[model samples]
Target: MPKNIYFIALCLLCIWGCRESASKAGANKKDSINKVVQDAAHEIAGNFSDQRSLRFSANRLDSFFTRYDSLRTFQKDLTTFYTERNYAFAWYSDSGLTEQASHLYVRLENLPEEGLNLVLPYKHTLDSLINAANTQTLEQKSETELLLTSLYFFFAQRVWAGLEESATQKIDWLMPRKKLSYSALLDSVLKQGNTANVKEPVYRQYNLLKEYLKKYKAIPASSTTISLPGNKPIRPGDTSPEIVKLRKKLFLLGDLTNAGDTSSDTYDSTLLTAVKRFQRRHGLSEDGIAGAGLIRELNIPVPQLIEKIMVNMERNRWLPTDVRGRYLAVNIPEFVLHAYYDDSLLWNMNVVVGKDVNKTVIFAGSISQVVFSPYWNVPASILKKEILPGIQKNPNYLEKNHMEWNGPDVRQKPGPWNSLGQVKFLFPNSHSIYLHDTPSKSLFQESKRAFSHGCIRVANPKFLAQYILRDDAAWTTDRINKAMASGKEQYVAVKDPIPVYITYFTAWVDRQGDLNFREDIYKRDAQLSSLLMKR
Candidate 1:
């Protein structure tokens, strides 16, 4: 065996023996373990890696895997990781452990802040080494080197890469997975001394949710539930004993900025504003009413909310980091379409998503075509299940609907009463789903707008169209309206296709830094929560 490798083995054996003796010592166990770690760290003598030049042997690197067999899954990655550095020690220097080493250890210890509850391999050993404060010897430095590498991989995979691509596909997430180069990321971290670059592999939302996770975790448990008197809705200026409890709940939830006089029962303007903010966050009708719905949301335990934040964090992990620049995102659960430019949300409008029976798929594509006065080509499935049956029930069903036969298929003529309204945004996919204007604008008024067959129903399609065509000076707002009202189906090719993401984020942090939660309209939260638990 190589000298450093042999030395590491001997020191580990002595440390284990001393740990056993300490376990029997009871009162002095912690002291004995600390002393043993410090002693072993000083005993092994060899030239460790320096600040500018790393000097660990590749032969000893092979022995590292043989010793830490549990981390064998990372052998290929660790090999490539070292080969990229010409067999350099990543977490140490000639003087002592590098600054990045301590930072990594602190972050690893506080993994829960990243919405993870992972029990890392050899964590106790790493803990002892980090606590020793002086890892000068080659054996200690080399062991630290390999362990840090393994832990880095573990952290990167869970916190950044998230679940495997196949696993996300099984969960019906067809969005492109964020491709990461772990070796390159580590190089940046080591060279720049900016561990913040670790966040580059995932979407920005992941870090936002991570920040909220820490805040949510620190929230004290509420022993009492906020309930309305006789389940009656309380409007502004209404007075009731329940209002007192409501104020405190809202304060703790970050809705009410001030809980002035928690004993007061009057529903003042201060409380009214908070109620509306809370309602908006919960995807409710923001009428500033303290109803049973708002009370129920307030009563939800902090731990459950924490779990929700964590679940959405996992979903954020499954997203491609390239969704930035300029894009349109439709959050299914929130029933809203958000237009973003360069990571800044420009505007948003209400949208009706697919019902549970015909659930919309989670995916991404580029909007290449916008059809004005779109003909509602009745799908074959809809034809067989709905139109054909309607025709059988009534002979004049087709004529009444302004439908005519084209070959073997049926299509509604482009008109005001057409099922697809006057416009449709197309992003061709196998699911045949797209965003289109809806005649039933009343559906958008509902709190839960999941009435579509599978495609999205945009409440403000005209405005969306104008925004999309803003770059083309010839296609003005008046031109877009004229195109829609022409009653002739016109397909306009987009000059620069905009990326569109159909995502299902039931919980997210908004631009105002306030946390928002929406209903899991398709009941996907439970399924995702189960998967996260198993992970």
Candidate 2:
């Protein structure tokens, strides 16, 4: 043979060898894909067929099927699995099957069997992919297996996060350092294999939940009460310096007679003063006489007052967290209104709250607007029941009281006799109530002034109007006085809206931290106290 002929032969032989090697490589890859598909099918079948091993196998099979199409030559098996109900050769392979098998193993690790139920509907596609993978190349099979594994791990993490969030409850007040014994609880919950293990991280996430349960469970359902000390009487001729000092502390200067000596009066000034002071403190008229009301006030022990304050503080905590920053704080027991700004008391004054039958509600809202010399839109209950009856008895009742009837509405003309005082600070409430100046100035003189239909009665209307109008260029003390003096009904618009919160608090700590107690006119404290005990 010639040299050219020999060279041509060698080239042909090299080409043939490369083609043969390529063919072998392709077969090995197909074999690997087939094996993965077979293993995945077995998992699916075992999951659905065997009761004990069903859950784990199903999850493993679902994970494998999700990535089945990514395997080379596995696409045919995947399609067939969905089209046909074959399971045995679903994941069959010719060569390199062990590499793809490793990927499937990793995918099944740490995933609970309970999660497999979510994947049962796609069993056919999983079966098909397993059966078709037998013809895939080695490289294709390895890539498909790795891709499936990655997807399984990603989905598993999501499942775990969701389960943790559901099982763990966030508690706001639990201390962070406290430890919880949740291992037993976890064991109980996991007996059916429906949930994951209560891992160390899970315990950390649920610490707050555990702490709250413990705290709530430990709280006693009843409150303990203590009795007050009985009152001691002061006698004449027994004028010790201490008794005289005590008498002076209890009584007003006017109530004291023959201050230096204890022997000169028909009624002992010291005893009378003590009685007056006691009466004043207990929402009774500060009369020197030890009347029924005065005696009652003196009998209430100091400790009971402290208990009332503590209970009200707890009630305050029950209020919504976002209470208005600048709002009216009406101490019902103190019969006072303290305007609060930035959580500090700006100014305070004595106030007349609603009557016992028409007690003020405990609620929160904004003072949307202020109505100057506003009309008292009397409540329906008061209108039909009280005013209507009075009008019937005396047809001239409206004219005499400077009240005009406009259909069902009754308007009070601006004057001393008007039910609403000279200037009313209007903070509209849903309960059809407002904080306004009252014409019944004498009511403010009473020690316990719970006489309103429902509105708050202010003692000094001019002062409140001045405070509110300070920011307005158009409103001033002079402007307000002119409006009221005009004698015709006028409305002064507030430049800025102030929030008003009409709350019923019988107990609270004063600016001095001195615990103050108000009379439980509505008896809400008693009810709440009972509830606290039950808790």
Top model number, TM-score: 1
In the range 1-535, model 2's lDDT, one tens digit per residue, is: 9554565566556556556565677987656655755664454333233212211222334555465533333333333332332222212233333333333333344222212113322345434444556765543453344334333333333222222221211211111122222323222322322223323223121222233223323333232211222333434444344444444333322223344643333346557655564555455655555444443543354344434543443343334333445667676767888897766678888899888788776555555455565666566786789778989999998787777777778776777667776667655555676778876787777777888887788888878877777788778678878776565666666767776656666644355422234577877667655543442
Q: Which 10 consecutive positions of candidate 2 have the poorest summed lDDT?
A: 167-176
lDDT of 1: 0.84
What is the lDDT of every predicted structure here? 0.84, 0.50
Model 2 stretches astray by more than 4 angstroms: 1-298, 301-310, 320-325
Q: Who wins the lDDT comparison?
A: 1
Candidate 1 lDDT by residue in tens digits, 1-535 = 7676777787788777777677788867768677866765643321332543656888876788898998888888989988766787777766677777877888788888888667778889888877774834677777888888888888888888888888778878888777887778777677655475444677888888888888878788653487778878888999988888888778778788865646678999888888899998999999998778877888889988998898899899877775557899999999999989877888899999899999999999989899999999999989999999999999999999999998999999999899999999999899999999988989989999999899999999899898777777989888999999999999999898899999999899998888999878888888878877787
lDDT of residue 514 for candidate 2: 29
